[model samples]
Target chain A: MQIYLPIADVSVNWLLLLAMGGGVGFISGLFGVGGGFVMTPLLIFIGIPTAIAVATQAAQIAASSMTGSIGYWRRRAVDMRLGLVLAGGGLIGTVLGVWFFNVMRRLGQLDVIIAIAYVVLFGIIGGLMLFESLRAMWLKRKGIRRPARRSGEHPWYLGLPLKMRFHQSKLYGSVIPLALLALLIAFVGAVLGIGGGFIAVPALIYLFRIPAAVVVGTSLFQILLTMVAATIMHATSNHSVDLVLALLLIVGGVMGAQFGAIAGRNLRGDAFRLLLALLILAVGIRFAGDIVLKPEETFSLVTLDN
Target chain B: MKRSALALLICLASMATATAETLVTSLSTYRVAINSNYTGASLILFGSIERDARTAPRAGPYDLVVTVRGPRRTALVREKEPLGPLWITRGQRRFVDQPVYLAVVSSRAIDDIAAAPMRERLKLGLEAEFASPLPGPNLMGEDFVEAFIRLRRQQGLFQEDPEGVVFLTQNLFRAKIDLPAIAPTGLYEVETILLSDGVPLSRQSTNFEVEKTGFEQATVVLARDHGFIYGLIAAASALVLGWLATVVFRRE
Candidate 1:
């Protein structure tokens, strides 16, 4: 069945949209990451205008992450103080990002910018994930054991002013790095139409040395806020958020995430990471090919609302 | 000289009577409601020609051309240049206030209907419709206009059918106009023109509205009129859906 999207001004297949949401939701639940990195590109591939796809996906991300964050909250795994500090920075970054988004759109270069951003961001993240997971598996098979990490050791940067203790993560770190990291993620998320949870989870793990459980919850929390900001910005400024499209996606996504959570219980961590890495790399390669390959039509047209 | 002038006057009088005609046209529907199930719509523009019949029965055949034009909007056309490894947008041309959707139906090929200037004046074909250029970026010649037309056609926003208009009888005729699934909702103008001996005898135009109705209309109004509230409702609904799903599935 086909349904007309109000703001996007296009009719799309409802089944295809539902399936895309389900697929992304499954990945989000399986990995404990918001699937904006996957959903945004897929939506564009299916012919949703890039601007509408980005804005509408932001709302979907917020919805998908809400339940996950709540589950973590019940387990007391969320670092609320840390999440709030990061969200503070995120809110500021979102303003700047949306401004830049409008500028590129007006110049008729939004598609190229989105494509390049996807190629670079996903390429690096996927490559690192593959390398790290492979190394971990290799080390596990070997007889030699790696040195245990020292939790108390603080990097010189963590010794900076405005230090705060995240009681749940059991670490004392300066807010400067955490805020800066959040700001960067929010800026990228606004422009690229993603929740940036995938980037945040790794950053918190490797850079801040936050515990795995806390990182997921904290990342989700920050993601929820960042996406809310994005949705509001796109709705008011660009008026590109399509609520009908969002509702259809959320229906499949909500259910799929539940099933994915159950399925994730049976999967191994390193193997799961490897699979996700491949998926990310595949999407990145597809985007890269779009730029390098000759286009079917060298000329493109868009109707501007008078 | 007097005899020649009188002969010319007699010929002109006969031609005027032969060209005297009346056109009657109506759409299948006056209002097109874009409901949820609306993929597209096909409307038949049926019409008839009433000739003076007082003149010597014109030996030539009659022709009909129908054109449907949707709301006009500005469009941007951009051409990409291969810049080393990747293609980059090199230049752009803007068409100001051009019909967003245009469909033309004719009994015969438009070019065969009349001379080039006449066809252009009547806007009988896509090329003729672009006679006036809106002032913007350097006019990149016919290539850009052709590109615009081709892109719109591919998107189902523009269409043409030479044989769409068919004559059921000598004076009665009908044409079919297919609005694609992606057609924009707005007021559309449908025009039918009668041609006799390569000269326009009569013309008629009617207006119809294609507006979203029911759920579709409500959503659009909410988003455009109350965007902030709409955003809040969207976010709140998502939160509720997520919470509900989690609670229901927790038992499993």
Candidate 2:
């Protein structure tokens, strides 16, 4: 079928669209990223409406993450109990987040909100990730012994109520904390149109002290569920999901993810973290730059009223 | 007889003077084709200036404006940037194979030091040059090949550079299109307009048909039958190839 874009006097080519989807999918797979960072902006650059881009990206994330999560699960990397608890909270958070997302949309303040979130969160998260990766590299160069165990007692996280043991992570932690973290992450994910893996992975590693070996798997599991919920919510409430666009990206992403998983196995811990950190930092910087600098032209569909 | 001849000469002179001050030319109408991959497309406008002397044909410093509209009668793109002797690339790429209407308007006030009345009566004719079918760089290799193949199979279809076509020195214009072999047969129209001093003066439109035959019908049927399964297999193969290529190329 011929699809025409009157504004650009251009027609859509299905083959080209599929190729683009595949390319983005490959990147996501290799990098273990949600691909939303690149996909959303690229869509905007290519003249897609922003809301459509975000919704379609969410669906794509759901499909691509399913493969990753399944792969990780097969490898005995997923902690189902932990993933489920976190996902339960994530569902609530995502629901709330959808409302908040719509509220911001209605207020015509999405761009400002997105800009601020990118600058603030990206600065903090990217900086921390960078610093940690760099420090790990420095220690390795100095031939310092790696810290494999904690000498002190379990921290305050262990002291909270409703503590439960995560067999895979081998830690006893309060379920409340896990739930709260999931909710917070999901809320951010919904608002930012991301899968929340970036926040969740870091939170699991630093806050909960989940072993690095299991962190990514556990995070993917949670991301998988959260994205699924987000997709359904957006589809039902906002009627925003563009299945055609989502499918195109997913087809490419699945292939990319397969390759990424293969490559990731070969990288050392420091190298992996450094690469991931740099990627995050790069995305953050680009996003921040767009917001801080005055655009040559600015147009929006939303009017300045809630 | 002498008086009548003088009167006739006087009338012709006045008409020539009026035509010399503002000239409108017809440019070729563009038939847009959209690539199905993109969600939409927009148009971009640009032009340059030229200068000239009296009785020497007008030269340089031409002020040109361009606007595009869709078949549904909505404004697609517009530009008003002014520059002298400029080659402007409107930072807009449309989806492939979709038909869109274009309207280009150009106006320039010639600086004449001659008598004020003479200048007022002096007329200028405006001409437009259409950019021919040139392959856009961004068109992926695969899409280009497909479009090229389709174009080759269509009878009575004039093959222009897959890049684009450029028509120079005519103002109001239109395109008569003949669809390709693989193309779904339909009516396509292109409209063009020329304006002087913000006033609409000349307008033209062209219509074309895409006729389908047995071969085209068979190709469509075959494509429909196995397109999904074929796409899946192709994608899988591409992934494997891409992976292998990356590994080989980046071996360390």
Model 2, residue A38: distance off in Å is 3.1
Instruction: Write candidate 2's Cα lDDT for A122-157 as tens digits.
Output: 778878988998998999899997777775667786
Candidate 1 stretches greater than 4 Å from native: B1-19, B132-134
Candidate 2 colliding pairs, count: 76
Writing each residue's lDDT as its tens digit, candidate 2 over B31-60 gives 333333333222222221121243223343
| Weakest ten-residue segment in model 2 chain A by summed lDDT | A297-306
The DockQ-derived docking category for candidate 2 is incorrect
Residue pairs with clashing backbones, model 1: none
**lDDT per residue as tens, model 1, A1-306:** 888777787778899889988988898888777888889888888888999998898789888888888888888888999999999999988888888899999999988888888889899999999999999899989965778887568788799999999898877979999899999999999999889888889998888888887889888888888888788887878878898889888888887787788899999988999998998898889999888788989999988876
Task: List iRMS for all predictions.
Answer: 1.2, 13.7
Candidate lDDT (C-alpha), each: 0.86, 0.55
